[model samples]
Target: MSALIPALERQPDKPALCFGDVVLSYAQLAGAAYALAGKLAGRGRVAVWATPTPHTALAVVAGVLAGVPVVPLNPRSGARELAHVLADSTPDVVCVAPETELPEAAAGLTTLTVTLAPPADAAPLARPEPGPDASAALIVYTSGTTGAPKGVVLSRRAVAATLDDVAEAWQWTGDDVLVHALPLFHVHGLILGVLGPLRRGGTLRHLGRFSVDGVTRALTEQGGTLLFGVPTMYHRLAESAGEDAALARALGGARLLVSGSAALPVYDHERIRSATGARVIERYGMSETLMNTSTRPDGPYRPGTVGVPLPGVDVRLVDDDGERVEADDGETVGEIQVRGPNLFTEYLHRPDATNGAFAGGWFRTGDVATRDADGFYRIVGRKSTDLIKSGGYKIGAGEIENALLEFPGVREAAVTGAPDPDLGERVVAWIVPADDAAPPDEAALTDHVAAQLAPHKRPREVRFVTELPRNDMGKVMKRELR
Candidate 1:
């Protein structure tokens, strides 16, 4: 309504959203949302059971339309985590689909069961004016890796700014149809995947669950132009495309292929490219900042880099002393700090956290990265877990993991620092062998890493595992590894 998502009015009859067999046009989606909005008007804050269904999307739109801040609860969260979020956010009501069975923590809240479609006899309501652009629109919670999850308060201005910036960077337009199977709880899925298409006046087809067949059908048979996914999905496609001819052809036919939420390994990037002739566009951002950088639709699809900053976003790298790391060699890594309109307003009600997040108006992102001479930024790892300090050298765990994946017998790799007497920290690798019967020998893996990277960066010890611990977004939980 604030030009945040002009598609609802601009292309009223065009296909807007699809989940399963139900396809809702812009008119239908808006009508349902407006009807629900009239019911929820003046409600303070609302919690949404963030399922990947049209009902969830409609409820979110309805809450925003009614000028209530929407808080999306992760369906996978445990009771303690759910309790913490409900207590911290203090939502007045919770909206859910008819089929959703919410956990015990949300049982006592005022619940509203959203219908799948609009009622036939209901009269069309007058379009309401939008709320203030500076007002809070969404209160997204962060993963409680270190402590309890904190709600990140994002304004309507920030969300619109990010969507517009990325729209320019990626040549996104109303003619495109976006496809993804990501969860609707987090920024990657809810904000970017669901809201992005609506803002562009484009169509969104959500795969209820990710599968090679579903993605292929959407891209080929359904006129889907853009595909957004996490690395794990791409990895599966790469693995399947070698044998599935239609899947590879469908991937090549798509106008844009995007990967985010975590770094796509260099090996998977190459594999997908070689098989499908699709270059996966990688982007970087977090809950606090919606989107920072994205590889342009124009060119230069680098394997390990996330590309340059988006429009209206200012990015800088700072060393341990907080001085700028002004090298162009792309070897020196530093903590990324950003100043932009796309950043969240504050951590909801946590003044201490909100105050600590910004350094002189630039939000200090704990992610470590390197910048090339041409302004492209390559994320190395997170400073708290993946920056391995061994023998006076600051090593990025990502590069070493890439090196390990390049070796013949490694399926997946995760690197972290372990306490060492001689070195401050020694790089330890947790590996999933390509073949369990013939796991890669420690000596061979060590030699390969020493040759690919530096000797100091090689893993001091390697432990084989069936699989690495991952979060819902498919990010390796390095904190658990340590």
Candidate 2:
């Protein structure tokens, strides 16, 4: 708390945030957070459900500094999801967005209404000295599709370690201005987007919701230096900027643009670079671990690889037999296990799941990848989702999808295994067509696949769709296809 306040005091006059016509200076931001801390002093856990505005940021900082765990609720979540999270976290206070009704669980709990207006005559609160093991943050939801959300407990040391690693790797400083569009409820936005920048005294411009036009205007008008987004955002931006030389020129000012939350195809990465002249850096990370590895800015940026591990991080490839594979052989593919200070402590209340994830000490990441001779790693696919067995042959869906993406007219493709009595499972391909182009027929696609892939790897069926089903972060949910 003291560190953040002192940093804010040093840059009191600097612009802290800009959304539409509203602009808040550093001092104003600090003051509002201090006052909110005063209001939430006695609260143990508070649930905040508001847009990613300046007020929301202040409230979160204040709650954390006041020794309270802030549970950032997703505004887009349905009533059932919201109820489940509230029941699980059991926050003592509920902070609702302006003009929004309080949840039923807030009947006896204190409700604080958040607004965009700055408080008057507010004084900074006394900074609390928290121990390293203090529970500084709480994110109460998991990404699993089948079960109710589970809360994840993170200590101050864990969050600090993740932010420090990111700040050092990305070369973040006070002069950088981050344009944040991801949802705050997710770890990507909270740890990487909001906390990481603020720790370095950098400013963050939060866009409550993502839209092509809104983000374009911010990049063109706000002089944003850093941009972080999912792959889908980059795809939309590429489409919006195509053939518009002026818009393309406007985007040239950004120094760094990052894509995460899902595997970014090399095709989209190249398209973004060709249109905007900004190299899109792709990285590998997950909700459990805040960040793992990234392509460095000054080093060779591999198109398909997610670069070497970040500082203070260790990665290893363990085969199905649970033995480490030699990095020299590129043919070996195994579970990409990680060990670092940034790894999550455990899955809250899921001892069995947590026990299964950790073997000997390293956290077993479910994704599968192969390390090249040069130490760069390429994520082949998820071990559980991307592995397909058909006709007594084991096939990797990611390899087939990558091959399909190499075709001239194929924009995007997803391959899944369907039930088949004869082969146990058969390959099925779902594709998105290029602009003004009809999808290739089944026979044509089959012939194209046969030309590039082995007979067993060929997709037996082809289905064309306008768009793939994605979650909020743009990760294609393959389970839905199953």
Candidate 3:
């Protein structure tokens, strides 16, 4: 708290954030947070369900400074989901902007309403000094693409570790202006997009919603020096020609560009470089552990790999039989396990799930990967039912699907292992067409794939599907396809 206040004091006149037409300087931001803190006195946990606007950012800072655990609720979440989380967290207070409705169950709890105008004569709340072991934040519910979402618990130290690494790795400074369009509820946007920049006294340009035009304008007009996005966002940017040139010029001044959340296809990597003359650095991380590895700015940029582990992070690959695999040759494949300071302490209210996720103090990532000769790591796929094993050979569905995306008329593809009596399992490909034209013939796709893959790896059957099922974060759910 002291660290943040002094920085805000130094830059009281400098712009701290710009959201749509509203602008807030550091001084105003701090003052609002302090006032909000006064309203949150005696609150155990406060739930924030507002949109990802500048006001939401203020609420988070206020909750943290007040020593109350904050839960960021997704705006699109249904009533049931909201009720489940609110009941579990048992927050003493719920804070939302004017006109927002709270869950019926929340009627018993004290509610603090906020608006664009500052509250009058709001008494400053007594800020509690938290113990080192206390929970500072609660990230509500994973995407739950495969099952019910569970809340992940993180400590102040853990969150700080991630912010520190991001700041150092990205070279953040007071002059840096970040263009943030990612949702604030997710870890990527909340920690990396917002908190990380603020820790360095940098300014953030927040977008309430994502639009290619608005993003292009912000990058060009605001002199945004950093861009953080998922692979889907990059793909959309690559699809627009007019925005492509604008993006290229806007990104020309950026020191770094990062892509995560899901695997980044090789084609997207090459296209981004061709269009912007900037290499998009791929990183590996999850909700359990904020960030583990990144493609270094001073190192060689490997296309398909997630690069080496970050400083103070340890990674090991263990086969199904529980034996460790040496990553030196790049031939070994196993479940990736990590031990780092940024790893979450546990899942909120899920002791059994938490116990099953950790082994000997190391977090089991449930990801399959192998390291190259130079220690660069490439994620093969998920260890769950998502992996496709056909003809007695293990195959990463993402690898084959990504390769198929390179074809001219193939917009997207998904590979799944289908039961086959003869071969135990056979590879099946599902495709989404690029246009109204019928999908390429199965034989033509087979021949096209034959040029790139071995016979055993080729898909034996091809099926065209209308669309692939994805979670809120846009991750394809292979379990449903199987």
Q: Each prediction's TM-score against the native?
A: 0.98, 0.91, 0.93
Q: Which lDDT tens digits does candidate 2 get at residues 124-202?
A: 6665636546665656477666477777666666677777777777787888888868887778887777767777787
What are the Cα lDDT values of the candidates? Answer: 0.89, 0.75, 0.75
TM-score of 2: 0.91
Choose the strongest candidate by lDDT. 1
For candidate 1, write residues 370-469 as lDDT tens digits: 9999888989988999888899999999999999998988999999999999998999999999999999999999889999888888899999999999
lDDT for residue 432 in candidate 2, whole number 0-100:
88
Clashes of each: 0, 0, 0
Instruction: Tell how far residue 421 is off in model 2, in angstroms.
Output: 4.5
What's the residue-level lDDT of 399 in candidate 3?
68
Tell me how far the alpha carbon of residue 198 in candidate 2 is from the true structure, in angstroms, after superposition: 1.2
Model 1 Cα shift for residue 127 (angstroms): 8.3
Which run of 10 residues does model 2 get worst, by summed lDDT? Answer: 1-10
Which lDDT value does model 3 have at 352? 99
Winner on TM-score (1 vs 2) = 1
Off by over 4 Å in 2: 1-6, 102-109, 116-121, 328-330, 391-394, 408-411, 421-424, 435-437, 450-455
List, residue by residue over 80-105, the lDDT tens digit for candidate 3: 77777777777777677777766664
> Candidate 3 clashing pairs?
none
Candidate 3 regions with alpha-carbon error over 4 angstroms: 3-6, 102-110, 116-132, 241-244
